[model samples]
Target: MKDKVKGLVVGVLLGSLLTGATAFAGTNTKISVVMENVKMMFNGVHKSTTQSIVYNGNLYVPAKTAAQTMGESFTYDGKTKTASFGAKTGTFKYLDEVSYARIDGKTNRLYFKNWTNPEGLKFTIAGQKYLHGIGVILDEPYSYDDQTISIDYNLNGGYKKLTANIGIDDYTRNSTNSGSLIVKGDGVELYRKDDMKGGDMPESINVDVTGVLKLKIVFEATLDNGRQIDIVLGDAKLIK
Candidate 1:
């Protein structure tokens, strides 16, 4: 009932803290971001596409995924790389902190910063906001895990829930989520799809799509007193 909606989500590198951080683990070391031409005007609805793919090799251009493809709130800091892009930017909608994306592009599901704990299990981004602040906890903030949240993606066209947009997380145990960030396929719905409140701090929802092909944004969060969490975005996925 109180969702103002700010948005952008994508992250990895969770060492849980930093100090050499296992020299940055590697699961094929993935990274890829490209939103071509950058013309996705939310609040008014505008989507321009030229979509490319490398995303798991580290190449997300179009000015750093254009604030999570047009839903603001960004962050990144993998041991002094630095990247913090608050929400609410206008006049063509832009934000910067030396962006070229090495890391730092704030995530959704309400803020997830300070992470980079390498050898202990794995976590990798430790420089954001200013580009460098190593404390590493890179990944594992869906609330300490019980596990099951999967979301996938792949769409070529179709939309009009007023240009769809959503990602939601109800502060632990309450569970209220929704999804629809245009870019259809596989009936996308990452984490129940519905997150946006007030403005700042990783929250976004802008939907409009009917093109679903390889879109797989899943979710499965179960925790009331028991324990469960597993979420993945960027290729969309969630499990609990």
Candidate 2:
């Protein structure tokens, strides 16, 4: 009787151990994270953050970090679950791969590729191709005197500023390529750049859009004796 009891106890303990191990194995889950390789610079300094992620083909950084990068302040209210930046207030929500703060009042969107003229031409230099449907890229060796591309935007009077990153991307080693960056709205000139040369850093431009109804960005290049004269309007948009 004693031997039988001991054997029964041992069997129960082994069964329990096996059952627990199987349950643990069944509950184990695996997760995958995708990383993107890209460099981001803000205000002439490199900005690094672990919370940056790429979701749905868009790169998103932390709200606070992004605000700080733009030299702006950020505050979050736990009670109302809202994020406030200056005069703008919005609710924050986190998704699987990205997070966003939806503005409470009004917003405006102007994507460069969406506003580019479709009838413009495309060019290629040293096996790198640039399409006009996306953004304006000018690189010609006196093939044309001047090239122009038009972009139109209709405003709802809620936006406060128009911002864009404009720069030159001259691949030619010589220093003969030059051009001017011009922006006009409704036949009124808003912005102009006449001394754009090769190997110049990109500069951020902001124009006040108080009561403007229409907006247009024109990229015109005056090329000299050079092989390539590239100018790109990088990530142009409107801010509210």
Candidate 3:
């Protein structure tokens, strides 16, 4: 039965390509394409459901199928007519993609960085370099108390989880200073680390953010010998 259904689909595709049928977007514009039943594979395993199709000499596959096969999640919004492929199966938003409600930092503001060449946030943790992150660093060292950098993200009680890698940037690896990372949901502390040193591998944070109206991420620099701290929130994202 499955084979019969597959054959029917292929037959239709072939007929449309040969007759220069209109594309699937409901437009009247006629387009010529070539369809093929190429084998699909992912990570050395055969993927039967994700059959390959050739269009304009380019190989295309089902978006949702391919996303799921790559260990990611796919979601579609009918009202907004939007689709998303993200870290979680449902709707997902990266932390850097959103605006910060407030950032009470002693010096620099929060900034987003990617892992691309020439321009990106580069950090090394336990000898592994990460390519994506949101980072902030202090300009001056203060001895009065721990230089606190508090950043607030307004979730508005929409997302269920917040995941990230918290650590110190590799640029400050030579420094003996340390800092701390704290996660708070709706003014309640969810996670905390007292001492995060440079070169130490980043710590994974996956905490429940359900019903969290205001999420606060606090970074405290334990100033030592008048040195600065570079804290990075790597790959921070919200999952719905």
Candidate maximizing TM-score? 3
Candidate 1 segments whose C-alpha is farther than 4 A from its true place: 1-41, 47-63, 68-78, 87-240
Clashing pairs in 2: none
Candidate 3 runs further than 4 Å off: 1-88, 107-109, 114-131, 139-146
After TM-score superposition, the amount by which residue 176's alpha carbon in candidate 2 deviates from its true location, in angstroms, is: 2.1
Candidate 1 lDDT over 1-240, as tens digits, reads 012223432343333332231233367553333332334454676744533222445523333445554554556667867655554222121111112112222233211222222222211111102221111111234544322333222233322221212222222212232222223245444223433221213333333333443443333333323332212122111111
Ranking by TM-score: 3, 2, 1
Best by lDDT: 3
Q: Once model 2 is optimally superposed onto the true structure by TM-score, how far is the C-alpha of residue 31 displaced, in angstroms? A: 12
Residue 225 shift from truth in candidate 2, angstroms: 7.0
Cα lDDT tens digits for candidate 3, 95-199: 888888988855334557643333564755555565556776643454433377788988899999988888877777766778888899987899888878888
lDDT by residue for model 2 (1-240), tens:
222223211101111222111222234653233344444455457765433444445554455555555556766666876665444522211111122122111112112233223433332223233332223445444444335444555654545566555555434324465667776655588788776765666566877766666666666557533345555555444555
Off by over 4 Å in 2: 1-134, 156-158, 170-175, 224-227
